[model samples]
Target: MNEPEAVDDLIADLPEWATTEEIADTMRVKPQTVLKWNKEYGLKTVAVGTRVRRYRKKDFREFLLRSAEATD
Candidate 1:
């Protein structure tokens, strides 16, 4: 598959609500980097409880697409 399709397929496999570790694993970054993205970039997350945060798969997909387009 082409790059975009491959990216889509990868994103499609993510859970509806992904954890910091899951996002980091998918992007091949550290979990701390994912948290940094949330702080610096526009990666949004939802707080589940006092100490749990979950990222929306759709938001992550959009972020990846935007980043790819920016590099091109």
Candidate 2:
């Protein structure tokens, strides 16, 4: 399959709500990079309780798609 399709499949397999580590693992990046994306690239996050944050799979998918389109 093409790279985009493979990436979509990978994102589809992620849990509905994911942590920074999970996203970093799926994208083959360090967890720090995911946090940086949240701060720098408008990667959305949902606050869980008071001290935690989770990322929605759909948002991550959209972010990836947007990044891809921006580069092309």
Candidate 3:
């Protein structure tokens, strides 16, 4: 499946933060699932504004690696 537009934009722009949609697209999951993971697991996030949420590339990669290790 094609990556979501928001993810493509995020990659092209190479922002310091990624939106929930961007991360969800990378994982091939729904945004809601991403939010759940953020809440249940330690998917760390930082707020760019009062409501806008974003994930750091480094932290997200670390989370993915840790999660993979957990499954293995």
Candidate 4:
């Protein structure tokens, strides 16, 4: 039998969390818009120190879905 080769995990290479700028780019909006949503919609974030914050990939994806549905 041929030996199996190790493969890289493409999804794993992707960030487990996203920054505000990243989310804004994905949403086709400005970074400040992401911040606004964070406040008005109660979108969640994790504080990485006392200064930096991150949003979970899953949570931000869900936020996109819910916001899209709301517009329809």
Candidate 5:
């Protein structure tokens, strides 16, 4: 597969334990943008202690579903 296809596959198969940076890098968005989505969209997240935030792979899927629905 080409690089873009490999990236799509990687995102599709992402693990729940992956970090926000990993998601940001894969999606080509800023880390702050991802954090903003967590705050603004109520995207599912977990805290490692107090200050650190991590998003679930399921939330990413849900975001995609919501976006698709909105576009339709």
Candidate 6:
């Protein structure tokens, strides 16, 4: 891939402090799923502002790694 494409891919892979909607779009999952995960797993998150929720990059990476370990 070109430089820009590589950068975009990296950005996609990196954890972004994004809303449930954004996370759903990126993960190809539903927004409800994200909410459910938070409720069920006590996943770390932050409130950006009024009615705005976001996940940190480190939290997302750790979650992914944990899931992968479970599967393995």
Point to the candidate with the largest TM-score. Answer: 2
For 1-72, candidate 3 gives per-residue lDDT tens digits of 223454444445435688999888877899999888889988999877777889887677667656656666
Alpha-carbon RMSD of each model? 2.7, 2.7, 6.4, 9.8, 5.1, 6.1
**Regions of model 6 farther than 4 Å from truth:** 1-15, 48-50
lDDT comparing candidate 6 with the true structure: 0.67
Give the better candidate number (1 or 6) by lDDT: 1
Per-candidate TM equals 0.80, 0.81, 0.71, 0.67, 0.69, 0.66
Q: Which ten residues in a row have the lowest lDDT in candidate 5?
A: 1-10
lDDT of each: 0.84, 0.86, 0.74, 0.67, 0.70, 0.67
The full ranking of all candidates by TM-score, starting with the best, is 2, 1, 3, 5, 4, 6
- When 3 and 4 are scored with TM-score, the better candidate is 3
- On the 0 to 100 scale, the lDDT of residue 37 in model 1 is 87
Question: Which residue window of length 10 is worst by lDDT in model 1?
Answer: 1-10
- Model 3 sits at a Cα RMSD from the real structure of 6.4
Pairs in clash, predicted candidate 2? none
What residue runs in model 3 are displaced by over 4 Å at the alpha carbon? Answer: 1-14
Tens digits of per-residue lDDT, candidate 2, 1-72, equal 226676689887789999988999998999999989899999999988976889999898878877766667
Of the two candidates 2 and 4, the one with more favorable TM-score, higher being better, is 2
**Which of the predicted structures, 1 or 2, would earn the higher TM-score when compared with the native?**
2
lDDT of 6 by residue, 7-72 (tens): 355447545677788767777889998888777866577877767888876575566555545556
Candidate 6 lDDT at 71 equals 52
